[model samples]
Target: MASSHPNVVTLHRVFDSPTDPYVYIVLEYCPDGDLFSMVIDSERYLMPPEPYVQDRSRTDGCPVPESPEYVEERVKLDNLIKTVYDQILSAIEYCHSLGLYHRDIKPENILCSADGQRVYLADFGLATGERYSTDFGCGSSFYMSPECQDGAGRRLTQYSTAANDVWSLGIILITLVCARNPWKEAVLTDDTFREYAKNPDFLLDILPISRALNDVLKRVFCIDEEKRCTVSELRASIRGVPRLTASNYETWERLLQRGLLKASRPKEHAQVPVEKNTFSNPDTNSSPSPSPVHSPPNASWDYGPKQGKFGQGLGPFAPTSSDDSWRILEKGRPR
Candidate 1:
């Protein structure tokens, strides 16, 4: 069921292997491996050496850095994490809209681009069309929702697949930002998450992430499945923040291509930052200024990078629910 969505992995074609009784799928090539490796490797690489250490040697210890280099690295890392999270949420929303629930959502199942500009959700073997199924408890233990976990008798409890996916998303986001998993397994049963639940700000207190993200995470990892944020609601909560979307996908691709072409030429190097409006505030009625687009040297061949009519339009910043949500109702149907 793969499509041409930027966030979801693209599937070109499917065929059967004549030599064996297996079906083969042709998928996009992601040289950067999976999200799990990216998180762990980046942390180790970004970790500064010991006292008076100047070499860029890899170490087993993941020590936090406080130097200016660290500041720049952090900014880049945060932006990447935010982008990936937004894309994953959007992809999941799209999947649900099509009556599909990815029963398995974890780092190992996600693939990232080499340049770290994009991520694609992969491994849908456990995906199913039923949203409220209780027959099977499938998914990685560390990222499974409490309801989806096997009980004392190894019976699969009834659960909402959407909520279960949301739980996995929460775990992924926390891991990306903190560069570590807060709990080994069993989110509700884990002491770390229990403490954070008592004081929601505990996550912000530990990680140097934005309060906006902290609020989203708190809603995402709710103990009660009904209370946990849906993919649409989660998208709305972070709608105000700047992110890339399909609407402007072409614009970004062109900018990236141009930058890469320039970067290849010697002595041609520059960097520019794009700025967009924060249309999320409910009190504001003013039209937002145009979003800034730039081409920087770091925008290699594979890389580089709007708020609401405040959630009144489509895409990530689109409102959780509105009349416009039904605007394109029958237009996309093939009669």
Candidate 2:
């Protein structure tokens, strides 16, 4: 289901050996590695990598080279951060539309393309569907939400996975913009997050990010799940960035849907011999060629049409129609 979203790592195919208990899941290979490396690089340079930079020529539909100009680099870097954030939120919103939620959303699980134009949300092993519910904590401590943390050995209370994901997104945004984590962990008991939760202006004092972005972060890190912005709301909040347009999102969505349709089609069957112990090896490689597998009903995994909000046509968040609508929403937000 997630493979259909361009911001998600594609799952080429999954094959199981009848002779062994192991299953082989083929996935897309990203040349640029994961977002953790990108975060480190951003910190080193205090900006986005050259490949990901967006200069003014970006508005004229041209890619700019890595410039020696510092002011130009900083402007490009800010646009790049907003662009990445838009995709991240879109990926999460798409997952929610599928009734799925990613429990782990830290930088380590996010992958950037070699050219750095694309970022994918990877590592769904910790993700869960809406049907799941639990009081136990999960995911990395650094990005966990206040509710996900047990207060100094106290039992964790039941919490919404969707809301927990929003908290992680908040942490990720801070890491991307500030090039450093605001807190070691997000827990009400932790002095860092607790102070921020009480007064989010603390973020602005440390980092010189815009008030618009800070407002978004404050709602994302809100201690009360009821107050935290939903993925839909997050999309609306970030969509108002002047340089980050909606067309990029619509283009990726259309391309991903086409790819998903191709991948979802049932494949032709073929057999290849494999040794018994080979399945036990973690690094074992399979044939590069595609093979046939049973494709589930499109209704079960399809997320585009049913999950849209406005109407049957991409819902309320549809890129074409909702761009201006979202702009109006931004006007109503607190400064």
lDDT of each: 0.56, 0.58
Per-residue lDDT, model 2, residue 173, is: 78
**Runs of candidate 1 exceeding 4 Å displacement:** 17-19, 44-76, 150-157, 204-210, 239-335
Give the worst 10-residue stretch by lDDT in candidate 2.
299-308
Tell me the TM-score of each prediction against the true structure.
Answer: 0.59, 0.61
Local lDDT at 252 for model 2? 25
> Mind giving the per-residue lDDT tens digits that candidate 1 earns over 1-335?
64666778889889976898989889989888877667555442122211211112322211123357645555565566667778888889889889889987877688888555678988887898997987545776557776776431234457889888988888787666544444445444555555665777665433334556767778987767778999888877765644221112222334344443232221223222322223123445454342222222221111100111223321122221112232133123232
Candidate topping lDDT: 2
Total clashes for model 1? 1
